[model samples]
Target: MEPIKKAYGYVTRTHKGRPQVLVFQHPILEAGIQIPKGTVEEGESPEAAVVREMIEETGLTEWGKPVFIADDRWKADDGSIHHRHFYRLDQKDVPDQWQHAPSGGGEEEGLQFTLFWISSPGDIPLARGHGDYLPDVLEERPEDGLGCLEPSEDVKQVYLIEEGVERIIGETREQISFEEGGTVLVREQTLTSEEIGDRRTVTRLMASTNRPLTVEDSGGGGMRAVYAGDHVIIERDGGEKRVPLHHLPVDTFSVELLLRTLPLEGTYALSFHAFNVLKGEEQLIEIHADEQPDGSFKAKVRFGAMIQWYWVNTETRELLKQSSDPAPGLKMEFRR
Candidate 1:
């Protein structure tokens, strides 16, 4: 197989009042600004190839002496591979007269050009095939003192749990406990009862996690209950259903810690929505609440599907309101 050969050159310069770096605009690609470079023809010395490529591409005649940067193998667009030689030319020697070569092909090969000054290695965009060589150049000229030219920060670790009443905030696992003494409203629909009598459905209101509280029946005629992170499984119910928890709609979940600690008074609004995971569609349910003088609040929530809404007083660890709607298939209760 015939060996594939190509060459390109890059220029680095310092911008006045800005960082010192090299700049070159790509003629064909949009937002293509980086070091100028092109391929070398066959039988040409690597150094001579870079010189000729730079002159032909940038119109710079006085390209100065080519400084060898590195030599490595690379793959080209034609699927053939070749060894590449890289060199850097000082911007000080750039000739005043330089122009782009006219395209041998017609105008459909759109290309544009621009110039910029660069100081540090990080100032160069990684796209122009110079991404790898940029670091080497910067290391060789650390004294250039390019400001704001550094690698990005690493992502921090975090812990996320879907179940539970407490919002886990730290990176480690920890238990959150709540004390007693709170109010609970139980709503039941019964055909034979006084409120709505024989076939009756009852909803108990309480404070738990952001989702509804569920009571399961154990197989042995016992009962099992789960809310947020708390679970109690007896011999009664052996089934389990997972519910989603979300804060009142008005409060936008953000990375800002202060927003999470803000007092829940006239501060925000809440909305409920039904999410169909299978279809990736959502329908909003209107829910409203107000803070009471005793540091407690109340809200009425409704979703297309039976879902639970709980009002847990963060300060006193109380369940303020728990309710369910038969029409929506939601069941909930509260205990303090």
Candidate 2:
């Protein structure tokens, strides 16, 4: 049987020196996430077809030459042979995420697509066998760990607000005493209760392969946490619980270090485990960063019912302001 020919485009970019590939999903939830690809016309060459598919599917115009990578045989659900041609097409003129409605005629005509870049293609949710050729093009997907955490000695005051009135809850401090050349970094945080005026809680996290982000140990307020393989074992109130590690966890005590060091651009969204001492276990948290026209940034973070916003100077990556509601009718803010 003559193999049905198809061309796939791996639209790529170097984001913060990290090679990332573009992928999209149809607004229709069941369409599944996928890359730009199309069937070849009778006389259309693979190269030409790939270029046409890319422009039609992604609505991207500015791009470098599409480098052909390989030809593979894939079996379709109907047991038919699919002769797949893959190409690495580099593009720079796009945002981290956007909705594009393609005018290309066919079943998908006028259907909206949501496009975004993924540093690790493997992380694509329900990928439709569209990224099998990544190894021939991009560097190995980075391990799911803190990229590298180097915390500076800094202290900031925290204030609690209700309806609009603000008061000093306490101050949080971060410091790096001694780290032996990026091998292993010990991160320590100090939190105090202003109401008690005499009690303090100290929490320490460890992340050295890349960031001072914690993946190891933290303890305070009648709870102790330590890393045990891929899970964090927590001992609280005479009971033990384990939370599986997804993305390395980060907490309020450690977010300042990350905000100062993270690569902020293009309204990118990132996820991590959020560990709260007050909460029972680790939960997923998301941070969305939007780069402003002046090269500054506004980051929005969501964890459970609480949402936090931060404004930072892009040049220094310093937090200029922050606001969040820690509880019902209660707000917390920080400004510099």
Candidate 3:
């Protein structure tokens, strides 16, 4: 069916060793926290709309070029179908931070918009369904959300894993290496003992080619899965098998990586091996991903009578927190 056209931009910058994204809170509208976006004008391309919207809303003179990421179609409140297009722009030479009032855009022409940056990839707020396709567009971007360290530097980050009781029990150190040809290597290992308990879970993941945003390889334990050119090959349990990449939006890797490749309103059937923890259970799950107003993505995973919610950072693709309500396990968070 034909749908209305709209375009949105995700502007990003790295300031003071911390990554951030540009967002604004609409003064009058219930739009909440949002990235810069607007309607596509007559005879205007979606790419052009993104550039215009960023300048109109944020008043940024140099936002670089906008890269088209993904698109989605949905019915809005007014019963109009909206075909939303999403793009990403990484801005350089931006001020540490600033605020601005819209210069023009008619309705918001003079309205005060405090243009600001939020912690990259972490959840911020976005109004409407404007944020649905964040994961799909930003998942393969290692620089946006995944923290990094210098090539010669060893430790990138240190995180503390706490149980529901909130006691300081275990710690994990993450190391990242960027090899030639765009392949990323991320390694994380932790130690916990009698005083420690086995409450903490650690995971290792990697992403795809610079363009098209695919998951090259991601899994835990001794298992390693790779997305070869035309198909996906899996190696586990002392054996390897190849699976066809016949779907439009492939969800073959870990749930965390798969979330980044899906549009805001996209849905995919996650298979048994898609989850590192559930691989041996022979479970097939469905995943529905959406962007919250606060800029974080909330992914709902369901299989039969069981369901789980994972809150992930849009920039870093990190699973900030997770919970299974009315089920066993306390709400778990990754704290630094």
lDDT values of the candidates? 0.41, 0.66, 0.55
Task: Tell me how many residue pairs clash in candidate 3.
Answer: 22
TM-score of 1: 0.35
Models ranked on TM-score: 2, 3, 1
Worst 10 residues of 2 by lDDT: 208-217
In candidate 3, what residue range of length 10 has the lowest lDDT sum? 149-158
Per-candidate RMSD, Å = 21.6, 17.0, 18.1
For model 2, what is the alpha-carbon lDDT of residue 316?
Answer: 64
TM-score, each model? 0.35, 0.47, 0.44
Per-residue lDDT over 7-81 for candidate 3, one digit per residue giving the tens place of the 0 to 100 score: 888887767865566777778767587888888988999988889888887877776667655554545788886
Q: On a 0 to 100 scale, what is the lDDT of residue 135 in model 1?
A: 46
Model 3 Cα shift for residue 198 (angstroms) = 51
Give Cα distance to truth, residue 208, candidate 2, Å. Answer: 5.1
Residues 1-336, candidate 2: write the lDDT tens digits.
798999999888898988888888877887788889989899999888999998888888776667655454555788886787777898875689988887668898768998988887457663555766554446553342233433556577778888879888777665554333333345555656556343334444333222222232234436665442234556676776766655444555466556756778788788876666456466667889898887888899777666889887756646677888767898877653
